[model samples]
Target: MPPRMSDAVTGPAWASPAGKPPLSSRMMRATWRGLPAKRYEVGWEPGLVVPAGDGSPLITDHYFPRAEGDFPTLLVRSPYGRGLPWSPQYGLLFAEQGFHVVLQSCRGTGGSGGVFDLWRNEAADGRATVAWLRRQPWFTGTLGTVGPSYLGYVQWALALDPPPELKAMVVQVGLHDPYALFHAEGALRLENVLAVGLGMTYQHQGMAPFLRATLRLQRRLREATTARPLRGAYAAALGGELPWLDDVMTHPDAEDPYWRGASTAKAAERLRVPTALITGWHDALADQTFEQYERLCRADCDTALLVGPWTHTSALQQGWPEVFAESLAWLRAHLHADTSGLRPTKVRVHTGGEDAWRDLPDWPPALTGTSWYPAPDGHLTRQASTDSAPLASFRYDPADPTPSLGGPLLSRTAGPRDNGTLEARDDVLTFTGPPLTEAVDVLGPVSARLTVSTDTGYADVFTRLCDVDEQGRSVNVCDGLGRIRATGHASSQVTVAMSATAHRFAAGHRIRWQISGGAHPRYARHPGTGDPRVDAITFTPVHITLHTDSTLILPSGPPLT
Candidate 1:
């Protein structure tokens, strides 16, 4: 049983001078664009201590509208510190809109006590926070959770054994599986791992330390990523040794006991709480959001999805106006019991190339599958090739691995990027279709089926879907990487799931299928020796051959006329 409301010892409230909005709050309101002026001034209470399940102290801050009414409460648990963007964006902004927001730091972060163990402590700490909330005089007995990225993961963690007060949830650019974030197919996602390591190590210390760490990573990323033995290679860039980082980097297999219970995807399988999901086309966890939505729909749970043209970080920065509005609307409908601001559609996606927002009854909306095959002279044709020869061949050298420009990443360099210079490289093979006579809208999952043989028998295939403009500049849309082990020099048929997209390929633009051995740094260069990436010391160069029978599969509306 939980303690009574009066049993908790809450610290003093920290109001702004004369109950006025701070400069940062004013700036956020101006820059957030579409949001109207807040209805009330926000009151803040900082440095409140809540007890975790194991009696450890978890530091927290409270934000509320300075009005005379009882409002629903919102819970946001983040590993990132309670400062700057989070304090202003979620704490003050949402509170001013008539909700009591409790912004808390997970154990071992933001002055909280105890060692942070990634996904292990979240569930228990969340339940303990709610137990504390139950004793707060202003808790209102109604609750909703809201946040982005790892913060979103905390929401799912709490949902695993949600309290009766938990009613609504908003997950923005979120990830459910740490293993998937680090390893794709069989290759390690080197860049994302390093970026995450930097954040986990320094972001909680302070702004100065985090900025310095970011610069350090920027300066030494190449050295760290290209190191001979991959294990412990990121220590210089990340500041120091992180045992968890070393553990995750070394364990490439998902089935290993090390990764057991890492994924929180099961929480959504039968969730009854109303959930609102927001993601970007280039978000690292966009596919996870889609999978969550699918599971919610299958369970007949109320859910809404919003996908933008922004990246994981941009979904909160450039795309915040839409993301915030969607979140607020959902919270109001569920927690406040106000449906006036709800949209009529179940899903809203911003279409690229067309630069317009489309509201649909569902995502992937009953689309047709269009198949494009590779042909001679670097062309992509609608008909299959009967030629009995290899379509193209390229040599991949681990020493000078293919550079990854863009697509999906956690860093600022994510999203669609021009592949002109990259396409000019000998290691990349591109087969382009003719100029589209009519517009082609790609609205769902994209895949590449290829038959390829490598001299080393162990290699990775990087496939990308690109939109080529009149100037011959190819911009990547969605892409995927697959690791394959061939048998006795026989060609292997590998299908790479390039994720999904909601984009328009305007008339006169061309569609291209780009293939390469690997996207270095984005994915660790395959050593070509079938050894674990972290322990492999030998780097071998391999010749790869692509057969003409390969095809690109896209989900679209109708075929080009």
Candidate 2:
């Protein structure tokens, strides 16, 4: 049965005790009890049992409470230890806003029991955890999940099976298809995979031991300058030899089971709950998020999407306040609770260069007008001229391949910045469009249709959608990459898909398309040798022929005038 909402303006559930003080008051008491009265109190309790599926134990940390009276539940399932500053710092703020916050380590990581194998165990454990939460004494039977990256992935996975008690979700910067993300365009994501392995190892045990081992390895590497010390450090810290790393380094093709296991598209179709999907214009998983929204929209599910000018890690620290407010309002409405008058479908996206937020009823707007520009002499012009021009070509090398200058390369840092320096390199090809006579709002996925051929049998195409101002500074709006395989004399006509964005191209600004062979270490180079092994780095020249029939398509929103 659905829970009933109290009609009172301020029910007993929202009141605080007198004299002894409310939880927030007590928190203040604990904080300023000894020091100056100005110190803020943020109470957090570590290692609270949450009950595993079995009779054993599942432990999670509880952050801040203001006189708990069956408050709504906010669950966060993460591979990273719950004690990490990034997780709890943001978590306590939600508690302060009236919630019973719970942050649990995924099975096989931190204090949780079971072997860790990424998404393989998240669904079952998540189901068990939610079922257990429904029976908790303090639970109001209203629950919602929130997190970014791996934590966000677990929310999506649990929604695949969707517990009856689970109300809503806020998934931030998580991959929809693991294979496409981890092995984009058939190239192994070497750094991402390694970072995940290293992160799990440190979180499984704790940072102390991992830090010691890493320090020792760093010292050894400084002394030896060889790959052996680094390899040994990773092996020791991860507690096992990563044979998959070697596989990724050896196989540049996408026919392996390892790549397939990393994909989450199969699980996405099962998602049925109301979800607020968020991603950054510069995030590596932006493509996956956009694809998931498009797929879920086609399925006719209740889902809203938001794209901002931030990266994966930045969402929590810099973008959380606004995001969390919307998330909480969504949860409140869906759970049949009062939201204090907040709309159900509100989307605010950050526009690059301008750094402003634009609110809309729905993404891609209700009325979308499509515009196609023809490619002549590598220039994108709106006027369709039948002038035949020489094909544009660029050579890609594996050794000193394009370096990843920025744009959603996840690290310990937060926020989205510029990648323009990398975009100006020689390997990248630039095609500019004429300046717009009026402001044009673009919202949704941008795509490029290309009719091309490569001298070699295999190659990769990198495309970036940018906004070039009158001053000639190009800011990256959205980007995508695609790998193509040449089969004999077959035509190489393919569509390069870019990440979705919400932006208003100013009156004097011009739209531009940047085509290249690689985005560097962010996305591994496609060596062009067609070798199945990732470690076999070979360089080959591939002549690309871009036919005049090729066109760039931009999905624009209704006129904002």
Candidate 2 at 152: error in angstroms? Answer: 1.6
Residue-wise lDDT of candidate 1 within 1-561, one digit each (tens)? 122223334322433322444466567666666774676666777789999988889999888776655789999998888886788889888987888889998899999999998899999999999999999977778999999999999999999888999999999999889999999986999988998898888887877989999998999999999998989989888878999999888888899999888899999988999999999999988989999999999989899999999998899888888899999999989998889889999999988888899999998778888899988789999998786458789999988999999988999999999999999999999999999998989989999889998887988999999999999999999999988789646788999999999889999999999999999899999988878888879989889999988989999864322
The CA lDDT at 191 in model 2 is 51
lDDT values, one for every candidate? 0.88, 0.63
* Predicted candidate 2 versus true structure: per-residue lDDT over 11-42, tens digit per residue: 24323221222344345334322221211222
> In the order shown, what is each candidate's alpha-carbon RMSD?
4.3, 6.1
**Cα displacement (Å) at residue 411, model 1:** 0.4
Q: What is the total number of backbone clashes in candidate 1? A: 0
Instruction: Please list all clashing residue pairs in model 1, or write none if there are none.
Output: none
TM-score of each: 0.95, 0.80
Q: Name the lDDT value of residue 346 in candidate 2.
A: 53
Best by TM-score: 1
Clashes of each: 0, 12
